[model samples]
Target: MIEVRGLTKTFGPTKAVDDLTFTVKPGIVTGFLGPNGAGKSTTMRMILGLDRPTSGTALIDGQAYHDLKQPLRTVGALLDAKWVHPNRSAKAHLQWMAASNGIPSSRVDEVLRLVGLTEVAGKKAGGFSLGMSQRLGLAGALLGDPKVLLFDEPVNGLDPEGIVWIRKFMQRLAAEGRTVLVSSHLLSEMALTAEHLVVIGRGRLISDTTVKEFVDRSSESTVRVRSPQLDALRSVLTSHGLTVREDGHAASAAAALVVLDSTTDAIGQIAGSNGIVLHELASQQGSLEDAFMKLTGDDVQYHAAGVEEVMGGAL
Candidate 1:
């Protein structure tokens, strides 16, 4: 497990991470989410002992990363896939790391096969594509078979198949009771891969919760109902203290109403009681991306004003 308590980092006059505190437990995949320039990379660097924290502590299994005798065996990380030497082959690179950590050279081939890089093990890492470099980095991370793993943008240059493979691979690692923490900007993939989330913005902790709970808390959830007797249904729903709004694209086929603070079953029961004929009734909740945008709307560091203007003008 990874424990971060009151973690803070600063560069010159700017604060990169601000007293961030969270726990990454074993047996689950925790997504580290933030917009660009949200101090995610800085925080990860501090966690791995690559950067010194201005305050607080980041611990791996109750010990600082530097204090561990065999750091790779305790915690493995892939921060930058392109940070390897250009002259070394994939196999040579892993062999060097294994030697440094006292890991046997025999384990090199195992990790190479595990990451599907066995075919390219003899190839120079500098000549590898971004996807191949990511695979090699993953192989190095797994060489020690550590209990804790951290990956930053693991799918950066991966194809669709590679993305799917990494998703399943991360899940498999978590299933084996390893503590896994991944950071990525791909909200859709993160929604599918992560069970829990730790969201930050402007170097501050915004949220830390499960995916289901996060979505449930979003105010975007509304009950969409369509019926032939639209006026009557709307009146009944409004009289019950429910806010009803017209669907933007009401058609002659049916009138649709969006009911706030209501459920499909409740709306259906009300319609049934009033002898109303309903065409459709369904609950529409905001997606993960929607919730994330809503939560971090004010915290985003950059905005495309032109894009916003164009979208607003179109609307």
Candidate 2:
């Protein structure tokens, strides 16, 4: 298990990570999420002792990472695969890392097999594709058979199959009762991968909860409908006590109507009773990404401009 307590880092006047506190438990995958420049990399560096924190501490099973008796066996991380030299074969890379940590050469081969990189072990890491590099990085992380792992955006450049394999590999490691903390941008992918989530924005903690609980707390469901006579359909739907709003681009032009707080079944009731010709109707429950956006709204680095909606009538 790993615990970060009030971890903070400042570079000049900018605080990269601040007051970050979270516990990553064994037997589950904890996801770390933040926008670009949101202190994620800073926190990871602090964990590995690559960067000195301005205050607070990160611990691996109650001790700092550098103080561990067998640091490599205690924690494995893939922070930047790009750090590997271009001329070194994947096997040679692992050999050097293993030697640094006193890990045996046989263990390197074991991890290469663990990450399915044994066949390409002789290939230079620089010549490998992005997906292959990701795999090689993963192999290096597993080389020491660490009980704790930190994977920062482990799926950044992988193909679909590689992404799937990485997801399964993380789960398998957690099932063996290892503590695994991973970061990723694909909400759907994270949804399937993480059991717990620690979300951050602007160097502040946004949420820390179970994946399902966090997502549920941040999003809501709405109903979408498209029809030629949108105004009439909007009137009828809004009159039935459901909230209705006219979609701007979809309104007037495509004639689309958005009915808020309308369930899939209730939407059916609205259509049947009002005789509203529905070209499209789907319950639009927000996704994990939407939840992330809502939870981090104030800290979003990029955002679209505010949108306006035409109104048939306010609910």
lDDT of 2 by residue, 1-315 (tens): 989999999999998898999899999999999887788888999999999989999999889987987788889999887779989999999999999989999998898888888998998888988778888889888888999999999998898998899999999999999999998888899999999999999888888999989877898768888876677777777678888876665735567767877676887776777776777877777789889888887887776544442343432
- Residue 96 of model 2, lDDT score: 94
Model 1 TM-score is 0.93
Task: Quantify all predictions' global Cα lDDT against the true fold.
Answer: 0.93, 0.87
Best by TM-score: 1
Worst 10-residue lDDT window, candidate 2: 306-315
Candidate 2: global Cα-lDDT? 0.87
Stretches of candidate 1 off by over 4 Å are 248-255, 308-315
Model 1: lowest-lDDT 10 consecutive positions = 247-256
